[model samples]
Target chain A: MENPPVTDFATDWDHTDPAWVHDPYPIWDDLRQRCPVAHTDRYGGAWFPATHAGVSAVAQDTEHFTSRTVVLGNGRPLEDAPPAPIGVAPPITSDPPFHTIARRLILPAFAPGPVRALEPRVRELCRRLLDDLGDATEFDAATQYAQFIPPGVIVRMLGFPEADEDMFRDFIHVVLEGVNHPVEERIEEFAPIEAYITAQIEDHRAHPRDDLTSYLLGVEVGGQPLAPEHVFGTIILVLIAGIDTTWSAIGSALWHLASHPDDLARLREDPDLMPIAIEEFLRFYAPVTMARLVKRDVEFLGCPMREDDWVLLGFPAANRDPAVFPDADRFVIDRLENRHLAFGLGIHRCAGSNLARMEMRVALEEFLARYPHVELTDPEAVTWSQGQVRGPRRLPVRVASA
Target chain B: MKVTIDAARCQGHGRCFNLAPDVFGFDELGNGVVLVASPPDDRAERLARLAQVNCPEHAIDIEE
Candidate 1:
């Protein structure tokens, strides 16, 4: 196969640049048009697929694109990361048979019935949060609503002791910070998280309860019960997955809706559109930008990838791919036949997608119902967090009084 | 149509049950099982197909 033109892959991503963090879509679009399959030789040798098909192709081809413990950051692999089985890749980062077993073990706990059962509670929480916003003309949606709901639901689901919610939140921030922090600073940031999760595992083991942590502690994978580090790893994964992804989606969706009054009004006028609207929002604003390692040498979109190459799957870019999504840049809530890679594709796809969808749906529904004429206090001033997980740091909005 | 779940293969990702709870259900172990093998109508069948397709484990099979 003829090789695609080699573009310079060594562009440095300035995460500290506030402008890039606020909206990276323009840069992504430029890359997709200019260098669809480009390599960026920073934060390790990684390849970025700027187009929709390129990203999706790598994400779906698990055989060619494998996920191993090696995908874990520069730190000691989760197995040796202090918290025994908790950080180990029995499931999330594992491939195939082992991945299947670990995923099955946790599946029942997150099943729809249980998730649906939590809807009323979720809506109630959202309402209460919004209620506190009161007639305040302006408030940051991320802290007020987006940030709180996911952690609240995740803590309840994981059976984390209510007292340690703050600890968990802190751990999540620490992990996020560590993802971009220099190697020198990561050790310090990761230590507290490891210690916290380790203690939680011990507590769950001694005082078993009807929670996910307790169940994971008792359940054996690959014959022996999961190690403490595996449990911690899984918990950390779930916490990060649950909190950041959902929080980002909520933040982005809220920002989008607030900016687009017509779209918000359409949903308000006809609540039936909310379901499809949620999917459209997810597609238009993919919260997570993931990276998968090429397991073997393979050619994708006429570009060659060798083993150990990091293929960064830009979900937002895929969702916005003009070829896949007509008028991809425009947000059409009723856009039919929309199959987005926001939650990813194939086996490694997001396990908590259902819950994520439900959270977005409920939050949007409640927000629309509560404040029909809300507008961004200053759309240009709203900003987003940088790193692999993308979302607004603060989404300020003002609700017109009833 | 018959619905089968590979208990061993299933990670209990819960996508199937979440999509079509009426046709699929989980056992005490959190493993998936057919709650209704034969649906009462086309609507139920449509949902059952959705549940089967959405199963990330590919655990649900509907043989027509």
Candidate 2:
């Protein structure tokens, strides 16, 4: 079959098109094969690099791909963005030296030990939530399981009262649904969250505790105590980065497992395979569609990216790059040489990656162990979210009676 | 294996020592300081390698 013409790319990505929002992969695949570095003037003159190498190169080379501005059509500099740290690229968006210092202060809390310590608690939380599913044959797994777990963990880590978890979740939802609302409205929506985090930081300052909030509050950068704005910004960044990506992963894994019963059976039989399975799941369903700005004018893959040009790193596309992985679409839990960049690469890799992996592993292990017979009621009924981070919005499954 | 840490690069994040305490120790400034010049066993060696990977500053280097 002949590949479609490059001009067809424009028809594929309409921001308001609900169908495109649901499944942008087909469009992305077509663009990747035909025109890897395709431009879309639809959403304020954005460029979408659909190929594996094209996007990965941009993500890895932060010097070439700066993160100073909001890539998602928000024209404000990150520092001035109202969502505070989440919108601003402090540690993640900045270059080395400053980025290195900020990241160092926060890295210890997310090291393997702390993540491992949370494993038991994450498993228990998954079990309790799944147990409540009861005789109900159909429930949105995204809302029931995936959405609840990450925020719950975040609340605990931040020392926020557990009762306020739903509020936090709602705040994230507002921030992520940037496509539907104007940038000003989106900033307004995040105001309460910013205020709340600021208050928490002040509280932590008054009574120093062992939590992450207090740790950040006490951290000194360049021999000076970190600024309150930066502290608040980092906190916001952690909340957004930690919650959405992990939830999307859990949702994607559930969908994949429920859709493929044989894989689930194999996983259930060998519990030790859970670790590799988690890695495979990430490779297959990398939830984030990252973007980076070209720091210098560069030419690659026969396309020239000028300085300040936005290059979208299609991670889902990269994970399925045939050159990197043989039979990239197939899910091989025991697949060797799996160095997928789902958590990204280089200095700006996800800080909470260890915590994310631990959470997913524990959740999946406990879930499969508790409900081995669980199966999707209607695989076709699964709905995925639109925008940068994509995952199932609704996943309906039933636990088969043993 | 010998693990070397550059305190100037280290922000005293304590992640290196947290991952492999037997090999990588921390000073009062929270900067990672090597306690064992040579890893005692295979387990120590593996932990030492993990410390290198997890170090945000890339301050720790392991020599075999």
Candidate 3:
């Protein structure tokens, strides 16, 4: 399902384009200067908002845009997908009053208090992953280190077996990366994923544990347990949303550090800068670009969006818009006046933000503590993942001590 | 200076509490809460201001 190479992104934007996948910052910058809102006939007419203002308006104006499907694909939800308000994934895919209820049910699990409690465990996980690297002078940091952290954390939270991590990664690839697949092919791809999730639910039910899966099963909504679809949907969200998003964040941050020796040295030199540096990394290399289907025919940001049109909400691009932060393009380690929308904005802010932050901080701390020096083994060889979540898929770095 | 958080706008990004822990805190749901309504000193006020501007939702407000 290869999309033809985009001739002009301003008019015909395709996120899956090789040019966009290689480096989107420049494309976004050009679009911002030319047309803040870029329209594409691809995916049955999609709009990409390139500016902070345009993105913010669309994100907050839930009345006009629906979160029926955050990931853009050939198949429109209005055609064959689940009814709106409660889409395939709860909260992330749900809209309005239903969105609130769905979000609140899982918010406590990722609240700051509980998330902070997992810091020690996250640190230990990072340490174990780093230890696996042994004394290798050169290694693929993205595959070897960053990729493992989120899946490891998620499996523990979901009470799934650690050995099933490979399966979980495969499911994520099918969902996030397979956006261009035809509708029927997409359904076939999800068959195994659906089967896997069904089995896990049964396992959690038979042997209820104190983990999130069991908790989701036990937690009542209103007066009764959540609908089976709700339970299944939320677990799917936890797996898809929680895994690669943070993994990309970590991998991209490490990628930045590997390439920028000065930034890396400064971070390693000033241990206090890790938190602030993490924010800059998130802003500069924000991995996620959520899609929103237009609720109805409407005029938005001077663009006539038809019903079911996909609005590719570019939080990553918004973070780079000069209208928001001073020197928005520059990565400022000690940036204090940063109001970056890496986790997004409004009512639909990322639920697992606190957890993601803790994981990234711990991952970087452990990696840096183990190897004081890290540099890109070959910058040209670095490849970024396509479709929505962007980050280095193959980040080869030299960790040799000088 | 006095500070307040618009609970409606505060979706609990936690920038307020993260930047100025002494002046701000979070509720059980992790939404920002103004711990120190009126800053005790200049330094506290600066930290409060920092939190205000850093808020992604612009939920934090400062009265000078």
Per-residue CA lDDT of model 3 for A1-402, tens digit only, reads 679989999999999999999989899999999998998999888999999999999999999998888999896844556655577889998998999999989988998999988899999999998888887889999999999999999999999998999898888999899999998888898999899889999999999999999999999977899888889999999999999899999999999888888888899889998878888888989989898989899988998889988999999999999988789888888887888899999888999998999999999998899988999989999999999999899999999555
For candidate 3, list the clashing residue pairs, or say none: none
Q: Which candidate is the best by DockQ?
A: 3
Chain A TM-scores, candidates in order = 0.89, 0.91, 0.98
In angstroms, give how far residue A353 of model 2 lies from its true place.
Answer: 0.8
Docking class of 1: incorrect
lDDT (10s digit) by residue, model 2, range A1-402: 111223456433443346556666577666767777777544444577776677666665655666665346544334454343333646765666566677777777787667778888888888888888776766777899888999889988988778888887777777765654656777678789878887888888999998888888887766888777678777887888888889999999988888888898888888877866887888888887666766667775676667666666677877777766788877897764465668765566777877888788877877777678767888888888766777898899877545
Tens-place lDDT digits, model 1, residues A235-296 = 87788778888988998888888888889788888898786687788888888777667767
Candidate 3, CAPRI quality class derived from DockQ: high
**Cα TM-score per model:** 0.83, 0.82, 0.98
Best-performing candidate as measured by TM-score = 3
In order of TM-score, best first, we have: 3, 1, 2
Lowest lDDT sum, 10 consecutive residues, model 1 chain A, at A1-10
Which model is ahead, 1 or 3, in terms of lDDT? 3
lDDT of each: 0.72, 0.72, 0.90
Best by lDDT: 3
